[model samples]
Target: MNLTVARLTVRGLLGRRRGILLLVVPALLLVISVIGRSSGSDKHDLAVTILGELSLGTLVPILGLIVGTGVIATEIDDGSIVYLLAKPLPRWKIITTKLAIAVVTTWAFAAVPTLLAGLILYGTQDGLAVGFALGTVVAGAAYSAVFLLLGVVTRHAVVAGLGYALVWESLVGNYVQGAKTLSVQQWGLSVAKAVAADGAIPAHVSLAAAVPLLVVVTVAATAFASVKLAGLTLASDE
Candidate 1:
């Protein structure tokens, strides 16, 4: 990996407007946590519902979409990736660097907020903070890899990511049992189940299934993104 290239890419991906936008989701989580905390409805189950369902289920995926795609999509849009590709650096290194940025940004924007929100909402009961935090970390990394690959493979990354996260993961997974088994939401839920106290949380997929899927998605997406980046073509306006 070219440290100079990686540094430049990370800076461009994370600076200015993108940085502010990245903060919004977590700000919303904190606001919700504050309200929930003040309302004196800090039951462990309620905390689980809010953090597990609302934060992990919804917010994290969206943030991942924005950040992961932001890392590569903007370069693609502006045709700046050509400069990076023209260099002697291996395409895999570029993808890996971008994937690393995406994962770190996802963790910063999603997982950290989740930990703070868990602290505010439930005050560390049942390892809820640790469990949900761990789950968020894992899910964020997966989301970053998947969304980054989407950016490499298509111009429609945000739309495709939304469709997968909202339409397929939420809607279809809820209605179709088999789909639930394949869902990232469920996979993270499984991790959360393992981390939280026994019976504190429920996950449709078991740990056996979730761990492998997470690893597979992260690794496959990274590998595929590297391959795609190596041969990525830019259409000339001429």
Candidate 2:
């Protein structure tokens, strides 16, 4: 990964309005988690609902959309990407560098918070905290890569990403039994189920299926983004 490109991407990502969102969204999760901990509810069930539905199902995807698109989408939209593209930098290096930034940022905002939320709500019972934390790491990475590719390939990356996260993963993946096989959320949940005590967490997709799909989606998205970036041509100013 190119250090210069990584630095610029980081600056661009965190030095804007999107930075506030990254901070606020995770903070909201922590706040709700604190409240959930104090509520007189079934801790395990609360933990499952909060971490499984709110954290993995919701937070990871939203942060993924923000950071993933923020890293490069603005540059691409404003035509500043051509300046970077003109440099003698490999396209794959650019894509990977931005992707790395997105993954780490997503982890910082989503994974860490999810872990904290899990602990707050349920403690270490059944390994739920660590299990869901690991799940966030994988899911966040996949979401970053997928959404970054969306940023590269389309002007409406955020809208497209929201539709996928909201409509596909949140709605269809949750309700449609067969659709769970193709969901990032379910894939991450599978990891959590494997790590947590058996029956502690419910995941529709098996770990065997989830792991391979996670690897495939992340790798494919990064590769395709690189290819697309390599083909990008700056529009001429009249």
The number of the candidate with the highest lDDT is: 2
Give a tens-digit lDDT track for model 1, residues 58-116. 88899989988998988997889888777778788888888888888889888999999
Clashing pairs in 2: none
Tens digit per residue, CA lDDT, model 2, 81-145: 98898888888999999999999999999999999999899999999999999999999999999
Candidate lDDT (C-alpha), each = 0.86, 0.94
* Candidate 1 stretches greater than 4 Å from native: 40-42, 233-238
Work out the TM-score per prediction. 0.94, 0.97
- The parts of candidate 2 lying over 4 Å away from their true place are 234-238
lDDT, candidate 1, equals 0.86
